[model samples]
Target: MNQYSTHDTSGAQLKLWDSAGPFETGAMQQLRNVASLPFVFRHVAGMPDVHWGKGATVGSVIATKAAIVPAAVGVDIGCGMMAVRTSLTADQLPDSLSAIRAEIERAVPKGMESSQTANHVKGGWAITPNSVGRAWNDRFEARWRAILARHPKVDGKTSDQLGSMGGGNHFIEVCLDEEDRLWVMLHSGSRGTGNRIGTYFIDAAKEAIAKERLDFHLADKDLAFLSEGSQLFDDYIEAMHFAQDYAVANRELMMGRVLEALRKHLPAFKTDKQAINCHHNYATRERHFGEQVWVTRKGAVSARAGELGIIPGSMGTGSFIVEGLGNEQSFCSCSHGAGRVMSRGEAKRRITLEQHAEAMKGIEARVDEGVLDESPAAYKDIGAVMDAQQDLVVIRHRLRQIINIKG
Candidate 1:
């Protein structure tokens, strides 16, 4: 039996798994807009955690033939999750989680007002650790310099930012899986350099559309796309791949930072088990339904059968490590995390500091008004989200966050 409900729009179709949580009118309309696009392949797939986003709805999986939409991919080019199961167990952790949180915040730069901010973190790894330098020199630096050769504006101090975590939904946490094993899980992306690439390409596509006067009756100008063979399209795909690689390396660098911090407080441990690093907000070429096409997962994760992905809950809740079932209909994808139920502004206005604090009473995380926007109440019920996508993935490890560090 099919696990999705089909919504027929003016063009193509939308297969949504709405049993976990219902989407708002705007979110549904966004999917319909993509469906109406001329290059969209087959149909659109909306995950259970579907919600509204900047250009396209979050939790959307779009497959296109001969064209790619940069806006659909969003700004956090390679944003995703990375997790590692440490040798330590829950009982081995310190009685107070605050020390761990403090050490992590100290080791990693985070919560900047914007990527351009000069004073985001006090005394950030100013000297650039020898290890981080080695990691970048090994692979990242050369790729970035090549991208800079073509697009100067996309360049940034990648050396300083490579291992850093940016603000918003990005975070680092120490969690305990169902088996009581300790784990280090973090969320980040390609950082500032990726942001510039994503923004540059998204606008470049729209600007090209405006310059050449090519309009396929686009409902929203942000839906602009570049044809597969176009020069701009080639440039974007190359740049995007660079950012994706940077993001992977970025997470690896941060995981190293976290492990170093933990080593100071606890017994020496190894993070060689159950390691997973997957990208949720990126696009790539994949074959589905007998045709090769570009697949963009906005707020989704690739869940090819047996492949592992991480789906995290809110600050107070927990997370999941799942192995994909490779559901072809959904293009082998699933939700990235608990989709936000309210916007940041709305969350700040509606949720009180007291309510946020109460919600995260046990978790070692920020409860100040500054972080009220990330309150658990601001997001959908994660349990319902998992239940809704049962056919897409099977839960491997359910991890409850014991130490949450927000950036």
Candidate 2:
């Protein structure tokens, strides 16, 4: 028996793992638009967390033959989660976590646009640390320059954004697992550089559609795609990969800094070197069914059997560490998070600041109106989302954040 329900449109069948929740109309339409794309290999899969996004629906897995959709990969290339389980337990935590949170915030610069001043250098680092500089120079500099040589428009500000957390859903948290072990978790991406590459290619795709004599016509311009074997396709693939690798290094650098900072307050402990670091909003070629196709997981995780991944909830809610089941029909993918039920604007307009504070009662997090959009109420029921994709993964650890830092 099939594990998924079909949300059939005209072209490719869209399989939905929405057992616990129904599809919203806007999200359904976005899926339909992707399904109708001619190059879609076999099927499109939607996770329980599926929601309307700028190009494609979040939580979608699109496998296409000889084509790639830049918008589907999204602007924040390689955006995902990283988690490290530590030897220390929750009982070791200080009574006042405020100081620890402050240290972490200081260690990792966050939020939008840094003034580059001494007092408050938010967003990018005020001064690029030697470690970050080495990592960039060793791993990224040459490839970045190569990409810029071809598509300089894709170039944007500050490699200092490396190892720093950016604003929005991006955050850093100190969590305690069910067994009460301390864990460090964070969510971020390739930052501004990745956004620039994605935005440039998304437009390039649309231009290819308009300029080239392609037989296909897109109902939605965002659905525009670059055909395989073209110069634009090759360039995008190269640049996109650079962004993805940069993002991984970005997370690694931040994790090291966060761990180093934590040592000041807590007893020294070693981390599980194989910390869970995986990307959600990225694409790669993989074999599905019998076809080797480009599978783009916009808001999904590659859940190949035995692979561990992190699925986090909203602030003050529960999160899970999971092992993939490698369910083939869904392309061995799972939902990235609880997924937003409301847009940031809608959440702020509707969810009261008082309610937000009440919901975050036991947790140390920003309950101000500025972070109101990220309140727990703004997201889908995480438990329900987990239940919906039971076949996709097995839960390893259930974690609750005691200290949370938002960008």
Candidate 3:
């Protein structure tokens, strides 16, 4: 068939494009939760990488009309992918990839620890922050000031957390495209700022319905929604917009640092082709299904016809540059990556370092114990994931990793 079809149910219609396989009970539960939303537009679209996430499925798309699910956007808020094509070819990279990784790790803070001088954990703002955070502070703080003026609880966090990559699936990689052109790709989000906004709004939405006769199961508390006309809803949109901007800026700033780190090894580097930064975890008002609706793409990317997007593979596998097909049934979306087959704890417990090293045989990256949870074996096969969404996206480029940096 030209395009894989979606599953339609009594309450909602859903298009599941999984070249990968059928969903597990956990994933199915999350999908059902999303489908249960009253305002969900048409059917929910589940990408090949569909997996169980905090409140919703990780690789699913939830398009809604009047109300928006803040949990569907999740706490990471603006989590997405960013990649840059550099002028330096594969030949320019040094045989020893350790220094390149070190440079990148040093350039950007990649852990849970604060690199800042002070703490601003109260509300959401950080205390003493880094240059990247400082640059974003003034703008975000102004917006936060306005938000807090109304809801004093919406405290601002430091931007020092902005450029820092968080733990778990988040990563940075130096890859080579099909033609052997070098590219750098990474995944991150709004950090502390987005988390604060998301948490605050989600709590407000839940409390807003505290006394209402809400169906517990039929009413997903996590799917706690904020209607467009409400004050909290407006604040959410504002904070969400700010977080999205922070996420994009975070990726840009980190990418710039990555380029600078690369220059230490290959001085003639210039980023040009294959450079893209996009948000997969945010909401936007758009005309879809013949009406103006707020599209909340939690783990899905905007796959409008012919749009360029990154579909990354596991640490040891190949990623893709895809052209969106704009499949209306899927809300014009596609998978983010090869979804996890198991949780991080499970992967760490089941996969071994030797297996990880074996899977990543050709790639120049860390095979240490800390990354065992990120082993290729821990994820669904990328090839299968791509095959599932044949109707959603067309592969434009196949990328293989050379050097990978993890946080």
Q: For each candidate, how many residue pairs have backbone atoms clashing (under 3 Å)?
A: 0, 0, 11
After superposing candidate 1 on the true structure, give the runs of residues whose Cα lies further than 4 Å from its correct spot: 9-12, 113-124, 213-215
Model 3 superposed RMSD (Cα): 3.1
Q: Report the C-alpha displacement of residue 218, candidate 1, in angstroms.
A: 0.9
Error of 2 at 227 (Å): 1.0
- Local lDDT at 170 for model 1: 90
Clashes of 1: 0
Candidate 1 per-residue lDDT over residues 1-407, each given as its tens digit: 55788855445588998855457989988999988898999889999889998778899999999999999998899999999998899888878989889888877888563322432342234567777889889987787788788889887657777788888889999999888999999999988778889999988999888877655688888998898889899999999998899899989989988899999999987777557999999999999999999999999999999999999988889999999999999999998988988999999999998999899888899889988888899999999889889999999999999888887
Q: Quote each prediction's TM-score.
A: 0.95, 0.97, 0.92
Error at 16, model 3, angstroms: 0.8
Put down candidate 2 lDDT per residue, 90-164, tens digits, no spaces. 788889999888788778888874555432365887778999999999998999989889888887764788998
Angstrom error at residue 245, model 2? 0.4
- CA lDDT of 336 in candidate 3? 86
> Where's the lowest-lDDT run of ten residues in candidate 1?
115-124
Best by lDDT: 2
Clashing pairs in 2: none
